[model samples]
Target: SNNDYNYTVDLSDKSLILISINYTVSETLEIPSTYLGRQVKNLSSSIFVTTDTSNVKTLILPDSLTTLDNTNIKPIYTLENLVIGNGITEIPDSFANYMNNLENVKLGNNVTKIGKNAFCGCARLKEIKVSDSVKYIDDYAFIGCSFNKVLIGKNVEYIGDEAFGYFDYILSNKGNSNILNPYYVINGYSSTAAEKYAKENGIKFIDLNNQPADTEQTYTYINDLVAGDINLDNKVDVNDVTLLQNYSACNVEFNDFQYKNSAVTHYITSITINNVTEIQRYLSGYIDTLEIYSVG
Candidate 1:
C-alpha cells in the first residue's frame, strides 16, 4: 500500500484481491476493476477487518468482481453505505449481520442464493432488493431486520425456516413451522414461492405479472414501386444499389413506423426495425414495378 494511495489491492493471475485500505481514506471508496494491466476479480474477507471508520462510509465494488465474502463486510461500525456489483453470485451466511448502521442495499443481478442469517439484526436495513436470478433464501436470512419492503424474483423456489422472521409468534402459533411474515409488502410472481409464503403466512403480496401484457401491433405490407429501394428509401438510386451489393444482396426490413415516416421524408435518414414475425416476399407486383423503373 502506498502512502499517497487511498485504496490497496493485491493482484494475482490478472485478478484483484482487495487487501486493505488506509485509515485516512475518504468516506466513499470506489475499487477499480483494472490494476497494473490486469483484471480484478475477488475481494477477500479481511479487506476491511482493520480499517478505521471515522471518515470511511461508502464502499463500491467493481462489476468484474466474482468472488467476495458477504459476511465480512467491514469492521467499520459507523459506515452506512454499500453497493454490490452484478458479478457476485451469492450472499453468504451471516452477511452484514448486526450492522445496524447500514440503511440500504441493492443485491447484484447475478446473485442466486441468500444464505442463512445473512442480514439478521440489522435494525436500520429498510431498503433491500433481491434479483430475479435468486433461487433460494436459506433459514433465518433476515431475522430481526427492519426492511419495510421486499421483492422476490420469479426464480425463487424455496423459503427456509424463519428466513424473514422477526418474532416467534409471527410464524406460527399452532404448528412447529417458523414461517413468519416478512413484515413487508412482498411483490413477486403469482403462484411462486414468494406468493405462497406471503399467502400462507398472512403477509402482504403483490403479483408481479398482474399488469396487462404489451399490446401487439400489426403492419401492412406495402410493395414499393421504385427500383433499387433495398434500403427502403422511396426512390431508386446508386446508394441503394451499393448497399445491396455489399451485403450479398440486401434483405432490408422496416416496421410500420419507419416505412410510413420514410415515405414522407425528402430523403430517408435513420431507420429502425421491430417485431417482424413473418417474412413476405416483395414480389407481389414488384416484378412489374421493377420493370417500370430501371435500377440506377
Candidate 2:
C-alpha cells in the first residue's frame, strides 16, 4: 500500500527521492516503493524521521533504496525498528544521529560505509549488525550509544574517532551498560580492525571466526585487487585512464573484470593523482551503478 508522501526526482538520472509526507501517518508504515512509475531509491532525512511524524513505530524501506540522506536526521523519538533494504550501499552522514531511543536496526548486507555520525547518541539502541560488506565507519557514528551487542563484519577496514566509544556526554552522565558484560565488546574476528579498535579504546572483543565458518558471512578475502587497477598492473596509471576513456567511448569492451569495477577503480585512483576530470567521469559512472538499485 502506498503511504501518502510527496517526492521529487533527479532530472539528470531519473532517480526517485521522497521530499515530504503528511503528518497524519500510521504508526507502522511501509514507505511506497514507486513514484511516477520509477522506483524510489533515495530517502531524505525528514521523510520518515520521528520529528516529522512521531507516530512511526516501524519504517520499512524498499528494496529499490540505495541511499538514505542523514545530514539532518532529527531524533527518532518513537521509532523502534528500521529496515534497510539490500540495495543500499551506504548509510549516509548523520543517518541516525541523536536518535536517543532507537532499540533495533536491521542493516542490509550490501552496505559498505556507515557515514559520519550515522548513529550518534542512540542511547537505547541495544543491538546492531554491521553487514558483512561494510568496510568503513566514520567519526562519531555511534557516539553515546549504549548497545548491548554489536557484531562488526570481518570486512571492516576502518573505524573513525569517538565511534562506539565513551562520548563526552556518556562519560559525564555515566550511562548504563550491560552488567554481566560491562565494557563495550565488539563481536569480530581477532587481528581484524575491530579487534584493533577495541584494544585501542579499552573495549572488549570477542572472536567470531572461532565459530563455524559456514554459519557466518565471511568477507575477509585473501587476495583483493585495488580499485582503478584496470590493467591488473597493481597500480592506477595513465594506461588505466586511457582504458576507461576508451571503454566509455565504446572503442573497447572489457576483457578484464566488468566495466563497473574498472570504472569504480578508476574513480578511486583518480583522487590520489589529482585527475579531477577523470575522477568526476568515473565517479558518475560508479554512482550510476549504485543508483540503479537492482543493476542488470
Candidate 3:
C-alpha cells in the first residue's frame, strides 16, 4: 500500500519537506519542476551543502520556488552566472560572498527585498540591474565591489543604510584608483531623490530630470586671492609701498581699505616694489636710518 491509500491527503496539507537525493550533477543544473508528484515549491536549508556541484557555473531556480534560505546550503564558490526566477521575493544574505568570478547579475522583477551583505565582496562584479519590484535594500548589499556603474530600476523607493557605502569607499580610498566613474546611467522615475543622495555623497549626479529637454552644460570658473596690494589698484609700485609703510608704522589706519570684496581688517605681511631704482633708494634710506640710530 506504499503507492496507494491516503497519500494525496498527506501531500496536499504539507508545507515543508526535507529530502535527500544521491545523484551527481555536472557543470549546469536545472531543478526539475515535478519532484515526487508535488511541485518543488521551496528549497530546504543545507540541501546542497554536501553536494559536489563545485563545477556548476549556472543555476536555474524553479519558477514555483518562493523562498531560498542559505543557512544550510553550501556557498556557490564556483558559480559565475546566476538566474533567479521571477517568483522569488527575497534573496538570502551572504548569497554572493564566495562568488569571486561573478561579474554580472540579472535579478527577477518580482524580487522585493535584498538581504544585508547579500552581494558583498563580489570584487569582479562590474554591473547590476535591480528590477522594478525591489522596494528595500539592506545594508552593505554591494560592499567592496569594483563595479563603477549601477542601474537602479524605477520602482525602487528606499536605499537602506550603507546601501551605497562601497561606492564611498571606492571614491575615498587612495589605494584603489581603478574604480572610477562607475555610475553612468540610473533609470528610474523618482530620480530627484537619487540625484540628491548622489551629490551629498560626492558622486557626480547627472541630471536626467528632463525627458524631451536637452542635457545641461557644465562650466568651471576660477578666482585667485592675492595679498600685498591693499587698494587693489593693479600695480605694486612706490605709492603702494608708501601706503604699506605708513599703515604698518601706525601713521595711517585702514578705515576704508577694502580689497576683493572683503574688508581689509588685518595688517599687511610683506610689500613687493616693482621699480628697481625705487628699491635701491629705499635701501639707502634704511641704511641712513640705521646709521643715525647707531650713533644716537
The candidate maximizing lDDT is: 2
Query: TM-scores of all models?
Result: 0.61, 0.60, 0.58
Model 3 per-residue lDDT tens digits across residues 106-168: 777799888887887676666667766887777778765655445555566667554552432
Tens-place lDDT per residue, model 2, 1-296, is 26456777879788878866754667776766787788888777666443355677777787888767542435446788888788888888878777765777888879999999888767677666776799999887877566545788888999887676444231111122111213455788777778888887767677887853222322211024344555656665667777666666668765322232343432322222323244445545643321101111
What lDDT does candidate 3 reach at residue 289? 17
Candidate that would win on TM-score: 1
Per-candidate Cα lDDT values, in order, are 0.57, 0.62, 0.50
After superposition, the stretches of candidate 2 with alpha carbons farther than 4 Å from their true spots are 1-3, 44-52, 70-76, 170-182, 211-296
Global local distance difference test of model 1: 0.57
Candidate 1 regions off by >4 Å? 1-12, 168-183, 211-296
Cα shift from native, residue 81, model 2 (Å): 1.3
Error of 1 at 149 (Å): 2.5
Rank candidates by TM-score, best first: 1, 2, 3
Could you tell me the lDDT of residue 289 within candidate 1?
30
**lDDT at 263 for candidate 1?**
28
C-alpha RMSD by candidate, in order: 21.8, 20.7, 17.8
| CA displacement after TM-score superposition, residue 185 of candidate 1 (Å) | 2.4
